[model samples]
Target: MQKSDYFIKGILESDEKVVAKIYNLFFPKVLSFVYRNNGQREDAEDVFQKALLQISARIKLRKLEVINTSFEAYLFTACKNLWRRELNKKQKRVTNDEVKELVSEESDMAYALLDQERWELFRDKLEQLSDNCKEVLNLFLKKVSYDQIVKKLGYTSETVARQRVFKCKAKLIEMIKADKRFRNLK
Candidate 1:
């Protein structure tokens, strides 16, 4: 089996030594990323734990497939995604004076899992596009100005950039919508 599969199996089998190795080998990178991304040490720790749990849950549910990247990359991405979700939640949180709704951990995990699925689906479809389409769509999605996109992509004019962005976005959406997973994601 591949090294990544060994880690996955360790996770699946609840091997303490393997888990410890993962934490030792990977957690420092996660900590660094979280620290750079408006997160504290505790936040990093929380996100790391949650990411592990998320992976565990996905494996148990048979939702995890191939780790197209390294296990380290996958874990780091999972942690990054969880951290981003946490940041968004924080931004959208009401003040202490306002009425607060209690959300359970399980519910939060469920939402995160579903959100991850949607993101993966979108990412996979995005990979199917031409390189030009990927670049145009990425810049467009980032809200880059048409002029900037035109300059960056060496387009003749903003209108051409706009057209390319529109076409690329439409193609991406069509591809995503054509996926069987799209229905469940929605």
Candidate 2:
């Protein structure tokens, strides 16, 4: 196994010594990344923690496998993405020059992580909706047409399916907006 695979295994097993080694080895780079992106020491720490949590979650769910990038690179990219999102939440825009410095592949991995996080959040919120709403939204997410949804869900007509989808979507949005974690992520 590669050195990074050991780190991934360590993370999966929750090995404290390995985790500490990862932090000791990679934290400085992540810190510099956050600081360069208009963040402070505390912000860097927060970003690192969030990135670690994201990585751990993915590992536990078996979502991460055969990492193509170095572990440090993946972690740093995640930190950068998290910091960028935090800055955006505060209404700050990252400059084009800063963006240009990111490796395309690393940035793509970072974005995939961010997208997965958002999708997970949305899915959690979706589960809190009524059964009919969940059904409609799940079908909609799968690109099922309204006519098909009506047939599948036994709705009266395509118009009813559309209305249900609209209402369910509105509820889902409202639930997402009301979540404290959602606010924090934003």
Candidate 3:
């Protein structure tokens, strides 16, 4: 059968293979989208994976029902909602029409924080890094492979890029720990 059919089957039956197929099909776009939106490649990849897990759970629990919408839309919306929830929890911003409109779902707000809160906090810190650091980390997190990173980033050598990634990540972790909003997670 075709790949599309395979993915549809996976969604319909909650089959692992189908889930994997769906991941291959749409995760790239979602990851790129997330990274472009102040998320790192790792953050995007992680969010996409967790979104799939959530989708599987919702399907199993009958909490998510997809009728006419494209699977890609459903998956993206779910991931986006999940990310917003993590942001709100970390930001702890008061509810307002403008803020509410900025988010897509409200139910996740009621659930207890999982590992997601910490990850989102980390993502926030990633944005605080210098532009070069953020770019390097984002590319590295996307699994560009060391050689590819050197090539794409215009680095003279893989070692330089690697060092930057290390320094940036270290600084990000330190900043997150120092920040009152995220210190509790450490």
Candidate 4:
């Protein structure tokens, strides 16, 4: 078994020792990250717990054959994403209590996980594109001007650059839509 699979199995089986080891091994880094990112100790604790729960829930809900990345890396990313979502919600809070809308924390976390999965799918699909297409798409995402793309890519004209961007984008969309996971995410 892969080294990471041990942890996945342990978590799935609720092995206490393995769980403790995970907390000892990863909690400090998560704590430090949250502290640096405008969160308190409590926030870090919450994020860490939620990340583990999300990972476990995902594994239970699907086969989760392989992590692709190391388990540590995957857990850290989930924590970072959850923390960022928390920060965003804070920023969007309504000052007036009466005007505040009710939102379920469970639903929010579920949505965050789904969004992360969709992003991962998109990224994998993007990596599968041709080098030229990847470069063009990256530049387009960064909002670079068509003239700049033309100059950088040695295209003859802005029109040519625009056409290339549109085609590449369409291909990317097609690839993303073709993935089965895309439907579940929606």
Using TM-score, give the best candidate's number: 1
Q: Candidate 3's residue-wise lDDT over 1-186, tens digit each?
A: 644344555866778777777778888888777776677778777777677666555455544333234677656766776666555654655544345434434344324233444555666688889998888889878887988888888988989888878988898878888888675554
Q: Candidate 4: minimum summed lDDT over ten consecutive residues — where?
A: 94-103
Candidate no. 2 TM-score: 0.50
Q: How accurate is candidate 3 locally (lDDT)?
A: 0.67
Cα lDDT tens digits, model 4, 1-186, are 886999899899999999999999999999999999999999999999898888898889867778777899889988998999898888767444555675798898788788668767888899999999999999999999999999999999999999999999999999999999888888
lDDT-based ranking: 4, 1, 2, 3
Q: Pick out the ten consecutive residues of candidate 2 with the lowest summed lDDT.
A: 92-101
Alpha-carbon TM-score of each model against the true structure: 0.89, 0.50, 0.42, 0.77
Per residue, candidate 2 scores C-alpha lDDT tens digits across 1-186 of 899899988987889999999989999988888778788999998888878877887777646676555888777767777777677655533444343433464564456575655655686788889998888889999999998998899999999999999999999999988887687466
Model 4: residue 133 alpha-carbon error in angstroms = 3.8
Tell me, by lDDT, which candidate is best: 4
lDDT tens digits by residue: candidate 1, 75-117: 8888888899898877767445566686789999888888777
C-alpha root-mean-square deviation, candidate 2: 12.0
Worst 10 residues of 1 by lDDT: 91-100
Of 1 and 3, which scores higher on TM-score?
A: 1
True lDDT of residue 103, candidate 4: 72
Stretches of candidate 4 off by over 4 Å are 94-99, 135-167
Per-candidate Cα lDDT values, in order, are: 0.88, 0.79, 0.67, 0.89
Global Cα lDDT for candidate 1: 0.88
Model 2, position 67: C-alpha lDDT score? 58
On the 0 to 100 scale, the lDDT of residue 37 in model 2 is 78
